[model samples]
Target: MNVKGIHHLSAMTGGITVNYQFYTEVLGMRLIKKTVNQDDTSVYHLFYGDERGNAGTELTFFDFPGIRQNQKGVSSISGTSLHVRNDAALAYWIERFTEHDVTHSPVIPYAGRNVIFFEDPEGQELALVSDETNSGVPGGTPWEHSPVPAQYGIIGLGPVKLTVRKPESTLAALRLMGFTEKSRIPALVAGQEDIIIMQVAEGGSGGEVQVEPRDDLAIARLGKGGVHHVAFRIEDEEELLAWIEVLNREGLQNSGFVDRYYFRSLYFREPNGILFELATDGPGFDTDEPFETLGESLALPRFLEHQRESIEDHLRPLVTKRD
Candidate 1:
């Protein structure tokens, strides 16, 4: 029972309109799904990535207007890595960011590859890596509003580096979740400079889990632009159940199965307070919309049928068209 690659990464955002513009217009990803946060109706939950909001191509957000900013520290998520096609494309992104006047750090090396680090309007750390081998995604998608082009954009996932307070307990829990310790290596990342620890499975991509030794478990306070949760892919319902059993046997607390529109999810916070979700891959984004017209409209799960009108009423009006 091993885990697969990343399905998507979700974050909290404050500005809805700017967040929409930056992800779609500037970043070049398809706005696959548009809806309000199920828990918080006032905020919008925006999804951006390759066409169809496919796995590894998604970077999701929950927009909270007028919220305070968060501080960058040991317990916080280091950053989210987006894989680009080549060094030339990486350079293109650098120029694009410059053209937009988005303040970014100079190019730095990370994970044995050169990378450029920057933050979004909300201070969520994001980076781009130039490693063709890491992500075999072609950089060209013909979708009208495809991000980075289907081919050159994030085809698959890289690794999500973390700074945990307790490595042993964290490692033990991950191992129970089917993660195996692979190796320790040198990192090319600029911000989290000290340790480069890694572990992974065959179907999934692994990132460095760097532990910054501390006194106790860190309580993460979410503000404007911070990662809300990191989700891992499960092949199907069977895999999801297996993990549920594993977690229960190990005495880990988890948010029992919740049926999301596109996928079924189970939530659990790791020892370090970073929320982790295990999501099923079947009955995917295409379940509601056809492959041809994905992201054409707002789709919701059948269970939320009664709330459809209310949900639609609360969402901000937006449209996606070919430029």
Candidate 2:
């Protein structure tokens, strides 16, 4: 079974309010879902994405108030890159960042694209890569309520950068999941490590994964602003189960099968310690609410419906302007 591309990239956050404002007001992504972590209902789970909350466009967060800042190093997802239409889109973002006082780096060239690096309120490394070649999935819909116009809004997730001590095992696991090496690039900055690019069978901008060797750096600690896990897309339950079997046969320990309500999931860790997940593409964000009114109110799965009262009472309420 071939893993298609990124389903969503989930990270940890310390302040939900600040995160909400930064992502919605500054980044211009739609707040697609406002729910609680299924494993830990006391905290909020926020999802931001393009219109319809499509598979490749999602960037989610788990709010853990008072959580310590993450220790960055090897064995972590260091950065997430979002795709922009072209150079003009990159320029638009630079201007927008300036107006909002967002911290950003000047546009630089890497991997045959112009990239502008930035950070969120909590310091999650992020970048906007100019996919001038229009190399992303076709027919991606932009959020209509986004402050940024649809023409320049992010197309989808671009190459995600992962820091690893060694690439052998990680590359092996990825190969089993249907990813093929695309290319490699030497480090542009002094003291930085070289990078290897991996792409799915249906290769494109969003389908790429960039791995940087950081063997000399210390291992990363999970905390606010660090990625919790990176999820890859599977077609449906059938593909999900097939992958579970494949992983089991390959002696890879994984979370058997998890019913996430919206989509089923399977969790595992690569040899380098970066958490990975295979998530189905169907029964998405709209499963709990209509597309027109997504992220409007607290949503709970059927099993958690009995605790909705307490869940809502324990968590702070969120109001999305466009919801």
Candidate 3:
């Protein structure tokens, strides 16, 4: 099975209104899709990305009301990063974060690239990594109308940091999925040993994963600000189906196949208990809505269209419009 690269990262949030404002206005991302979680239609599943919510550019959130803050530790997707054009974009973000009162760290190098770590109001661990040196997996185009200039706007998902307790098992799983060890880098988080960096096909910032073995920390508890799962991009349904058989042949259990409407998916937990998903990149966010006003109103998959009234009634009005 040939995995393309990072598909999208989904996370949890406690407050939808604040989250929407921060991502769209503060970070200058486009709300490419406004939909509800399919499993539980009461809460919203907001998708923020570039102009079209391309697979690699998506950073989505599920607003589960009253969820507690994320408990940081091991066996988790510790951090998610976004790709900016170059080092100069880092400076623009620092200034923008400061202006908007977004808590952030100074510029620093991690995994051979300059990045600035920052947190949303909900304490979501995130970073903006410069793609000045990238040569592999190309980045998506930024929304032309974003408040942040196109050069400074986030273009795509960058290398994701996965902190797990059992590095060998996770490493083996990754290798089975076509990733190879790239190199080792110092752990970005203090008190941890060197991190093992791995990359899949045409690896670069977009196609890499940083694996940190942290036996010293406790297992992370799921809550607001915690990442739900990180997905790897698959070229098409055929590739996805072939992978299912590969995983089954190896005796590794997995979600046979799930149609997520926008994209098909196969989910499973690695040895360390971190959820991993393999999702197709096609049938994108534009499948249901018009290209002009993608996220202007609530959008339901055809399957859920019948229950839209009840779904809308349970959801509180989330104001995303700017004056």
Candidate 4:
């Protein structure tokens, strides 16, 4: 079975308040889930997405109290993208970013699409891509009450950018996973000159990965403003099970059949040390919380429910409610 497009991206953040304000108010995505990191149980794991917290729309973050800023280099998820419906949406964002005093670049072309690359307050690399011509995998619905108008709101995730040491090694692993080499183009990404490699499934932006090969940089140091992992969409649990075997058959050592509560997952690392996960799309954020009151309170997986009090003990309060 083949995989779908992007599922969600988990990243690191140093502070919760500023990060929350930037994503919910500035970016205008809904805070769909307020939870603690299952692995650590001490830090906040916040999820921002479209109104319903759809699979392809989640951009999640894990909070670490005093982490260092990310050292930009090879072997990192260099950039994350958000999909907007058209050129007019991009224009609206340019104005909004300016009004908010957000640091952003003018619109530029790369790998057959026009995107406006920008950075969050903590130096998280982000792009707003124009989906005017996208016909591959579709984007999700925008939050109706988003500070940014619904018509120009950030819909779903776009292509994820991976910075690796060897292009061939990363590309080889991708081919085995069903991604096709769509196009390769050169562009200045975050002030560095490198080749932007596009690996995609036909014309779907969510199914795309922009891989940059750089021989002149050091391995990235993970901290605040760094991507922890990028998960690809597996249409169902059955396909995810098949992917477990596929990854093993390809000689890749992976975490086989992990039940993430919301979805099942399989985790592995490609040749370049970038973490990748194959995840099922259903049993989503709505599973534990009702649609109307999503993100209004802290949510925990059933497995973590018994320790909710202890987990809540370590959490620092940052009000997650919005208008």
- TM-scores for all predictions: 0.86, 0.97, 0.97, 0.96
The 10 consecutive residues of candidate 4 with the worst lDDT sum are 192-201
lDDT of each: 0.66, 0.87, 0.91, 0.87
What TM value does model 3 have?
A: 0.97
What RMSD, rounded to one decimal, does every model reach? 3.4, 1.4, 1.3, 1.9
Question: What ranking of all candidate models by TM-score puts the best one first?
Answer: 3, 2, 4, 1
Worst 10 residues of 1 by lDDT: 203-212
Per-residue lDDT tens digits for candidate 3, residues 1-323, read: 67999999999999999999899988889999999999899999999999898888999999899998899888899989999999999999999999999899999987788999999999998999998888788888888888899989999899998998889899998998899999998765588778999999899988999899997889999899999999999999998899899889888889898889999999988899889999999899889888888888899999999998999999989865434
Cα RMSD for predicted model 3? 1.3
Task: Summarize candidate 4's per-residue lDDT along 1-323 as a digit string, tens digits.
Answer: 65777899999999999999999989999999999887899999999999999999999999999999999888899999999998899999999999999999998875677899999999999999998877788888988888889889988999998888787788887777778877766645465445655545554678888888777789999999899999988788888888878887888999988888888899999999999998899889999999988998999999999999999989999887655
Cα-based lDDT at residue 31, candidate 1? 76
- What lDDT tens digits, residue by residue, belong to model 1 across residues 65-146? 6777865544556568776766776777778889888768766766566778887877877887776444322332324545
lDDT pick, better of 1 and 3: 3
Q: Which candidate is the best by lDDT?
A: 3
Give the CA lDDT, 0 to 100, for residue 197 in model 1.
48
Q: List runs of model 3 lying over 4 Å from the truth.
A: 188-191, 321-323
Worst 10 residues of 2 by lDDT: 132-141
Q: What lDDT score is found at residue 280 in candidate 1? A: 81
